[model samples]
Structure formats: C-alpha cells, structure tokens
Target: MKLLLFDFDGTLADTLPICIASFQEAFLQVDGVEWSEEEIEDILGPPETEILRTYTKHGDPEEAVECFYETYASLHPKVTADPAILEMLSALREAGFFLGIITGKARRGLDYSLRQLNMEGVVDWTIAGDETERAKPDPECVDRALQQFRTSKEETMILGDTDADIGAGQNAGITACAVNWLPGFTPKPLTLTPDAVFRSPEELRFWLYRQENPLDG
Candidate 1:
C-alpha cells in the first residue's frame, strides 16, 4: 500500500485504562452519571464531546470535554506505544509510504500522543475526531486522510484494533487490517471480516515490509 492510515487509542497506544477512568470522572463531575467500564468501551472510539453528550443532563459538552482531557492528560505518563511499532513506522516512512492517522481522539489528545510517542515525523497527516462530523464506522475521516495523501483507495490500507476502523476503511473502499493486540478486549475483529488481521506489531511489520523488501524472500 502507498498509504497507511492508523487508529490511535487501542491500536497505537495502551490508553484503555486512562480513557475509561477519564470518562467515568467526566460523567460523574459533569452530570453525576456513573459510567461502567463496559459502557465506556462501547463508545470508546469517538470524540470526547460525543461521548459526554450522551450522559449529559444539564451540563455543557465543552465543559465535560475539558474535564475529560484534564484527567486524560494527567495520565499521559501511563500511556505508551511499542518501540518496535515506532521503528516500523520510521522504516515505512523511509520506504516512501505516506503514513497518517485516522483516529477518534480529539486534536489535543492526538497531538499529545504524537509528541509523547515521537510520531510527528512518521505521521505525515492526521484527521482527528473533531475534524469530521462522522467518526469511525463512517468513511469521512478515512476519506479525508486519503485526500490529504492524494492516494486512491486501492493503494491505501487502514490498521486498527477495532471493527469500527475496519468498517471505516471498508466504507472508504480500501483494505482494512484488524489488529488483535489487546487481549482483554472481547469480540475479536476476525468476526468483523477485516481484509487482514494481525496479532502483533512484529507480524504486521514483517508482512508489510515483505511486499517491498527483497531480502524477505
């Protein structure tokens, strides 16, 4: 593929705990609502405002979003990306692939992560949560990334940990690579009919590079 679009949260980083905690805290502080872990996971890959609005009674969305980020940002030190994956991305960039992110994270969250993981050089463009009216399971974000990279759907791929990302890529007429990295998250993407499913970064790296690496054969 000439372009690779990635999902942020579970796919790139282990932000599950921090995101769930932030959601619970934001709901409690904003609307006195208590969100269980299951509820948070059900709506994990969406904009902060979109998730907040679902539980909001009389509170403002902007305020809840602010609260969520305040908590999420504080837990930034806990969030981490696999160094091997970072190296793989760098290799892809060096090989002339147009890499970008198509994530449900807000601009602030995505920016914080890109900086924290030192992915700014690898990720040439980003289509954040607030950038699109429709998120994952919809093709707008992926389409935007395709436009930015000026690549056709046949020459692009989407890699993510959830079916939503696969669905988005499918909706955009591209191959979707499902990542089964997070063990605790149930309902594997294999059942979701992804074009390809990778269990680890190493496997993905090998597969991706083999297409262009003469040494692999």
Candidate 2:
C-alpha cells in the first residue's frame, strides 16, 4: 500500500495497561468511583477530555483530565513498543509508503507516548481523536488521513488492534488489517470483518512484502 495508518494504543505500543490504570486512578480520584478495566475500556474511543466530561460525576472534568494526564505520564516509563515495530516502520518508509496514525487518543496523550517510546518523527501524519469531528467507527479520522496524504482507498491500509479501527477502515473503503500480537488483548465482537488478520509484526511485514513482490511470492 502507498499509505498505512496505524492505531496507537495496543497496536503500536503496549500502553494499554497504563491507560487503564490512569483512567481508573482519575475516576477514583475525581468521582470517588473505582472503575474496572472493562468499564474504562468501554468508554474509550473519545478524547480524554470528552470522556472525563461525560463520566466524571463529583469533580470538574477538566481537573480530572489533568489528573489523568499526570497519571499517564508518571506510568509512562513502563510503556514500550514491540521490539520489531520500529524496524517494520522503517522498512515501510524505505519502501516509499507514507505512514500515519489514526487514534482515539487525544493529541496530548499520543504525543507524550510517542516521545516516551522514542517514536517522534516516525510517522508522516497523525490524526488524533480531538482532531476529528467523530472517532473511529465513523471513518472521519481515516478520511482525514487519506485527504491529507492524497491517497486513494485502494492504495491505503489501516492496521490496528480493535474493531473500531477495522470498522473505520472498512467504512472508509480501505484495507483493514487486524494485528493481535498484544497479550491479554481480547477485542470486542467485530461488527465488520477485517480484510486480513495478523498475529505478529513479522507476519504482517512478510504479507506486505509478498503483496509488493507478487512475482517473487
């Protein structure tokens, strides 16, 4: 593909643990309510600010969001990308594929995680949840990337770890691939089937390589 879009949380980095922890801490601190991991995950797909505003009951949403960011930053040292992700991204770049990120994470959190993971300048473009009018499963974010990159749907692919990502890609008429390499990751039932499913970065890279070298394959 000429353009590849990725999801941030479970796809690019193993930040889900910290994300869940941060949300729980924020909710408990602000609302005096202890949210389970599943509860927090159920509220994902919006910007942190929106989620806080909609869910925080006993405190200011803005304040709760600030707390969330603080917790996220403090817990960030434990976050890490897959060892092979950097190599795969570099290979894609060398192959003239434009890389972009379409994530439900706010720009602030995404930027922080990118910095912490030493992934700054890795992608050519990023469309954060706050940047789009609607989140994934709506196709707005994916459409933004396609417009910005001037890439046709047939020339693009979206790789992610969740149903929302696949749904977004399908809604946008692009190739959607599911990467399920993260441990303990159980995606919600997918309303839309993915174009392909990969179990590892190496497997995905090989598949893309074969697509680019069909004769060799």
Candidate 3:
C-alpha cells in the first residue's frame, strides 16, 4: 500500500490563521508584546519554541514557551478544517492510500481538527511536535508515520507548505508534495523545491491520478 502522509495546518486544513491568533493570544497574556497580524501569519507552522525563541526575545524562553501553549490552547477549539481539504482527504483515503498526519501541532490540536471534520478514524496515525522527540526538518516524526503505516519511503509521499516540512520529507527519503496554499504566510518567503506542487485538492487529484495512471493503457 502507498503511504500518503500529510501536514495538518496548511495542507489539510486552513489552521494557519487560527494558530497565529492562538499564538498571539498566548503572547498577549504574557508580555502583552502585541504580535501583529503580519507577525502572527509569518510565524505559523514551525515548532512553538522556534517562534517563541525568535519572536519572544523580550522574555524568558521558558516562560514564553509556557505562555505560547496557553494562548494557543485558548484558540484551538475554534479552528476548523477547510472543506475542500476534507473532501480531498476523504477521497484519498477511500482510494486505499495509506494516510497519516505529521505536523508541528500537538495531539490536542490534531484531534480537534479531526473531530471538527469527523475524521478521527480517517487517518492511520498522527505524529505531532509535542508527541515527538524532534519536530519537522527532522526525519524522526516522518519515519514514525511511515512505521505506523508500514509503508516504504518510495511508496510514501509527504505533503506540506513549508521548507521545513520539505526538509523532513527529504530527510526521510519520502516524496515531497509542497502545497502552495499559504507559503506567503510564513516568516520568510519560503521558496520550496517539492517533488510536486499543487494549488488545490482538485489539482492534487489530477496530479496524483496522473502519476498513478500515466498511460492510456
């Protein structure tokens, strides 16, 4: 079976804005440093500490990390899965592709998004930043997802919208599919070199199906 590992926030759902709002709220409660909309959008998807370390330089890193989660917790429940994404996920699963979630978000956030879309059992496994010893840009989590799905690297594909996510996939020797849904939202203009890049679920479908069935034969 082919494994199809997905990144939760940008690839599967539109949780970036909610996550940014959550992080900002987390900071506001602590130093009231006032994270701007641009700042919030810029800081999406990386491990929480990276953002805390980079942006919360005004405060103690330890305290800022704690505050970061507190604020994110406050807003996570309100986040919803983008419907187009959910439909694509459903179709992919139905087609017998082994599916998994590999994300920087914690288990609580993953569960919330799955529950929001009634997809608790849709994916074979999930590995969150909080659930792993190392996060994205590292192959550990991606390896775990492949182990859970029992798929080989060649048969598995990793999808996300960031360079870090691509790094993780590359580290694990999985095919990287970079979704261009929100690359501009990151801190830097993340110029990614994915094995494949798609703009929407429909585009993804065409891409995957074409790859899986290339000939008129």
Best by TM-score: 2
lDDT of 1 by residue, 76-157 (tens): 7876677767877787788788888888887888887778766676778888898899878899998888778789898899
**Which whole-number lDDT from 0 to 100 does residue 33 have in model 2?**
95
lDDT of 3 by residue, 117-138 (tens): 5768878778877778877888
Best by lDDT: 2
Q: Candidate 3: misplaced stretches above 4 Å?
A: 37-79, 181-188
lDDT tens digits, residue span 59-101, model 2: 8888899999999999998767666888888888987999999
TM-scores of the models, in the order given: 0.89, 0.95, 0.80
Rank all candidate structures by their TM-score, best first, as comma-separated numbers.
2, 1, 3
lDDT values, one for every candidate: 0.81, 0.88, 0.75
Q: Model 3 Cα RMSD, Å? A: 3.6
lDDT of 3 at 204: 83
